[model samples]
Target: MMTISSSTFLMAVVACLLSPAVQALGVLPHTATRTPSSSSSSLFMVGRASADADFAKAPLTQDDQAVDPNVYNVNDLELAAQLWQVSLSSKTNQPNRPANTPFLDTKPFLPKDPTTKYVVDNVVVQVSRTGGLGMQLWELAGGRDDGCGITLIEGVSGNAEAAGVLPGDSLARIQYTTSMQGTQSSTTATEMDVAQAITTLNCECRDFDATMEVLTSLPPPEVVDTLTLTLKRLRTWPQIDVVVE
Candidate 1:
């Protein structure tokens, strides 16, 4: 019944606040059970775990699915206009090209070596020159470069380029039918015969000997009415790839 000491009174107050009944009554804050530093650390850990879970599942979200991560099909016209992927070597070449390029019946015939030199006509065009055929010819033996053919060394479009001829081209077959006028034929021919007959004669590019004969027998380009050369072109093309989105 006497007055209590200040220390004893303080102990009683602390015990009451920690009691289950007082805690349930909401006398103290709910976090009061743990130390301040421990409670703050535990909340931070829970927030980090939630963030990690959300990050792990982020790929399945809606906005991330809008863009495609695969290659476009070459024939997919709807996705974009004609795009070209030019390549130097056939190993990396693709048949697709821009619309401006003429539509070819056959795929591009890229010459990787002598065996692949001859094929379909890639670019069909006629070239004409007046004087000085502007070319040098060398006889290649069969054992020299896999086989034999007449190849031009130095020339340009203005001179020896009649019938789409170009430098570094090996003569394949000659067209003796077409001329500046039209289709023409030969019955019999000699050096004294008409120039038309001489031009219409069959080409002699069959073998090295025959090719040499034809080369030696050629009248001047100014004398012939028409000339068409079939050559296997070997040149290097630059590597360029274009993509239109």
Candidate 2:
């Protein structure tokens, strides 16, 4: 695989990645408890995966947590990977947001084999309005005209590292709750799909300017408060599922 490191353009694809093993592994809804973040700008639920159920729910406000990871084979990875990836968003009207079918447009970006699976991990992190995400991203292209791409995290720090976000993990979705002005302060989740961000920018001109605009449209480091991230890592097992949430 060809991986290039850059903080320049960070984007990825969102796909309705489903397979047999993935279907069998069903979704286990996780209940998260919200706590005050470092900046106190907002409260969010943060945790890390461990053998113990309680340990997996430790808040990021804490320095650390008990660790006893469960050993797993390739098949087991296929099973637990469903722990993160869930579904796609159908809401629209967000500027430059792709349609629900963009999930299909991203299919070519996957491996030629239909059965390849990935380990999808849901990690919650806090984004500072000033300090930024404090991480470097590796932009990966799938050699498609659809503008579909991938983002791999590196140089981790800030809440990302605290949440156990590892390098080489593919970023899928960034979800944050924000209050709307006219909506009576009603809160709604604002999500940024790394994959769809780049794809939506592909129109008449696929030139450098359009590419830079894609970068600009991304969820900048200035986005504050707590964010839940959907991350994907390649799995070695065959006949498994590929998840993108």
Candidate 3:
């Protein structure tokens, strides 16, 4: 729930966000397209979910038609967020850059109850070359570390930019998970039981769905609040080699 009204560190995070590659959402370049015949053979395709489809639906399938290339996938959009690196530093303390905050290292940074979903009200992602990307989370906007998807801001450089990721994008989810280490025990109330219960307590460290949106360039700011963080593997943007039509 930290506000970055005038903090230099806050400004640094904002500096890393992506620039406006497109003046408006509609002005981006024509997305690479594929015809029905070409769709099957095409290496990749970008499209929108059907009205009947759920917002939390899995990545688009072949059935979903190409809505537009200018429109990015959730995965691609989240890459922008990945470019940002968010950490905590007291206002009293100042550094050239904001320190990484291990907010979720212990305790339930996020609630364990399934009903209590994490939702961010307002999220701003900044990308940069000099520093890195910054994810500005606002509590007033309903953002928190325990929410679904990657709570920490991300940055993009080198490989990400070369792959066609643009600035001003926001990631929705990632596609990987690792077992948060827990204690081991045995007996009626053994250490293992305590460790297992604590370890299994589902605190979303990152989200794959949100990351997917960023990668694909289709993140909806309207729905940013309902997203959850998952421990998903990073999706590698499809490598493009010239193709002979």
List, residue by residue over 118-187, the lDDT tens digit for candidate 3.
Answer: 2121222232322221222211112344444333323334323322333323333322212233555555
Error of 3 at 20 (Å): 29
Predicted candidate 1 versus true structure: per-residue lDDT over 67-101, tens digit per residue: 22111111121111111111233342345433333
Candidate 3 lDDT at 225 equals 16
Q: Please, what is the whole-model Cα lDDT of each candidate in the order they appear? A: 0.28, 0.34, 0.28
Ranking by TM-score: 2, 1, 3
Of 1 and 2, which scores higher on TM-score? 2
Clash totals for all candidate models: 0, 3, 73
List the candidates' TM-scores in order. Answer: 0.30, 0.35, 0.18
**What lDDT score is found at residue 91 in candidate 2?**
73
* TM-score: model 1 vs. ground truth: 0.30
Cα deviation in Å at residue 27, candidate 1?
A: 99
Q: Highest TM-score, which number?
A: 2
